[model samples]
Target: MLSDLQRETRDEEIWKIKILSEMQRLKISFYFWREKTNNNLSYTSLMGPDKLKILKEFDLSAVFQSKTRAEQIRALWNQFYKLYLLMQNKTTTKKIFCHESQAWLDAFLAPSTGHPNKNNFVRGMYRTQDVTPYIHVLVNHVGEFLEIHQEFGLAAFSCSAVEKKNHMQVCLYFQNTLKDGGHENSQKSAILEMLEHENQQLYFALNETPNFFEAPKKFRLE
Candidate 1:
């Protein structure tokens, strides 16, 4: 007969294998690390949105589930959701005052005020895992930035729109511009072609009118 501790260990190993198999089925990549002391650690290659989707999709009240396993998973998912909400709250364009900044710091650092769950989540994550440099900056310096720029929010300083525009430009350039050879043995410059295409797009945007009504609700507003 197996001892209680041995049975528990066996169950844990089985659960780990099942979870890893499920992750593989979902096309999630698992990475294993080997350090100097022969310690093996593993993590999945899930992005932020992926993590959110997984946490949101997993239901604890589903049928044929182990209660203990479900509770453990739910607790971890709640922690991740709390962190997600905290990040979403911080990344907005709404003005944050000095007091609000302090509140945000409190919610970010210690688990005593504001949203204690989010604070505890961050604190627990920091204690258990290796956080990125961005997280380090978010924990230490973002509150200061918010306090100094109380007139505007962090969205004012975001580069996401610029990055997206650059991405679109690169796609357009690749699709429309010629690489090397052109008619009359002339070497066509892709950069020049891209600029001309951009100018044409701008001209159309400025001058062209839609045949269909853009805002039918506006026509009915009288």
Candidate 2:
């Protein structure tokens, strides 16, 4: 069961995947460049006020000019990569898909792991070398997410009870309904209903005891 925040993160990932697929399709057809003449007016004006507002929030801008096709693609990738990191504001180094180091064996048993007889050291060393450039890029791009995750210890928060309970109820409802010839649309409706019920339960519980976190009440010195 994913918490509301996790669901938001998943939705963002889905949106990024769609955007990246479109970019890849364009890249294959050389759509980002203009043949015969070096003009980028369309690119510069591609995103109007709404997009500019979003870019301003993250200190990002569309690169409308590049000397080479490779540079243009690289710029696009960099922009999307930064956007991805910004959206996923609580990711760990282990979760970084592109350039994660695999040095667990070496860390645990350095002398034995680094021996010539063992190939673990060789594989780990080469993998590190191959991804060195990407590692640098990730470090520069995702520093904000890393910093926030570390500062807040976001991973410490487990899936909320309300979310898990709702998930279980929905799953049970789906399974029971399936036996009665329930369809996909019905399953979705059932899940939504379960979620609504859980939400109301949470609202009532919070109303009954507002200080759920047990925060200390302030007292006047006078």
Best by lDDT: 1
Residue 84, model 2, lDDT: 48
TM-scores of all candidate predictions against the true structure = 0.34, 0.21
lDDT of 2 by residue, 51-112 (tens): 44333332211221112322333444455445444434554543452232222212212232
> Model 2, which residues run further than 4 Å from truth?
1-98, 101-144, 160-172, 175-188, 199-222
Where does candidate 1 stray beyond 4 Å? 1-48, 51-151, 155-158, 180-185, 209-222
Q: Give model 2's TM-score versus the native structure.
A: 0.21
Give the TM-score (vs. native) of candidate 1.
Answer: 0.34
Residue pairs in collision within model 2? none
Give the clashing pairs for model 1: none
Candidate of highest TM-score: 1
lDDT of 1 by residue, 32-134 (tens): 3455586654455677566666677644434114454355446655654554454345553223333344443443333322455563332211121344566
What lDDT is reached at residue 28 by model 2?
Answer: 27
